[model samples]
Target: MKPTLLAVAHGTRSAAGQRQIRDLVAAVARRRPELDVRLSYVDVQQPRIGDVVPAVRDAVVVPLLLSAGYHVRVDIANAVEGTGIPVTGTLGPDEVLLRSLTRNLPAADAVVLAAAGSSDPAWRESTHEMASKLQAHVAYASGSAPKVADVVADLRRRGARRIAIAAYLLADGLFYRTLHRAGADSVTPPLCLDPTVAGLVLRRYESALLTTAAGRL
Candidate 1:
């Protein structure tokens, strides 16, 4: 049997957020009809990762997260432990994701990438790297310094005629909506349900399977 791909997301209460995740999963299904694609959540939703992982005898878990942090490192890593199931890295710091973000971006004199911040320096560093690649500023929605509003304001103060926010988020949720109020000229939508993202999902799944096969050989 082909290995199942478990697309795990950090769930949210917003209805839009739920819809985005469902649509994203559907896109993945469309891309790889040969594989069984399933959805599960790490938090704030039903059918948690722990419950979902055990049901599948052979699987690869791909986190629908921008960066590897608590959920990806601790929660997901533990969920598949002792099961011999492979888990792919989080879906950011990649050109595929950057393509989606840039495609959806609105016109502006300057753009800022806003993320759900983390205390981990590595996560922040990765986000910064992506920002540098995109030629955009980096700020956090929460959890760290130089918050979204501050970043937006500073860009404007520095004489940026128009400021835009590219939400570096997976789905529509509280953080997605909150980007608009960050005082930017415009805030793009979350990086969700795009063909590029679906492609990235398949790429991660295929690469992990290849690595696992090599290890066993």
Candidate 2:
């Protein structure tokens, strides 16, 4: 049986967000036709993690996220229920991701990282890592005090000649477009359904299965 590549996302009500997840799955399917490719959401969507894991009881689960958090460790945990399929890590701020951010953002400009803030400390730290990598001033919408606009204004106060807000996102969906039109200065193209990301997913799954196999010894 082929080990499945379950692409999980933090679900949203926006149809665009849901579509992004689907598109990512399609990209991965194209890159690695070997694995059983599928997608599931954490909330407000069908095929919850609980539902996706059982379907591929023998496949490794990989969160289509940039950082490890409750979804990767907790929600995904509950879904797998000790099925023995090694779970992979989140996909974000990777080498290509860093390149994407650097290439997208203008040099010498203050960057304001806009991410879907979370209550979890780990996730917050992960976001910080993503923001820091790009040499951008990090700001969160849900957890931190300053919104995207607030951060942009703060940069101006800091004597930034140009404030280029880079969306550290993986898709051209709501967060990307909404934050893109925020009138900061210029928001670069978001991480669309690209082959680089698909490769990351496939490699992560392979690593998970290898790790699971090693643990047996």
Best by TM-score: 1
Q: Per-residue CA lDDT of candidate 1, range 95-126, in tens?
A: 98788888888888999999999988778888
The window of 10 residues in a row where model 1 has the poorest summed lDDT is: 187-196
RMSD in angstroms between candidate 1 and the native structure over all alpha carbons? 1.3
What lDDT tens digits, residue by residue, belong to model 2 across residues 1-217?
A: 7767777877777676667677778988987777788888787678788876766756777888877777877788888776876678788657777776667777656778787667778877888887777777776545555677778777777788787877777665556666755557777665644556677778888888788778888
Candidate 1 lDDT at 205 equals 89
The best candidate in terms of lDDT: 1
Stretches > 4 Å off in candidate 2: 172-174
Stretches of candidate 1 off by over 4 Å are none
TM-score of each: 0.95, 0.89
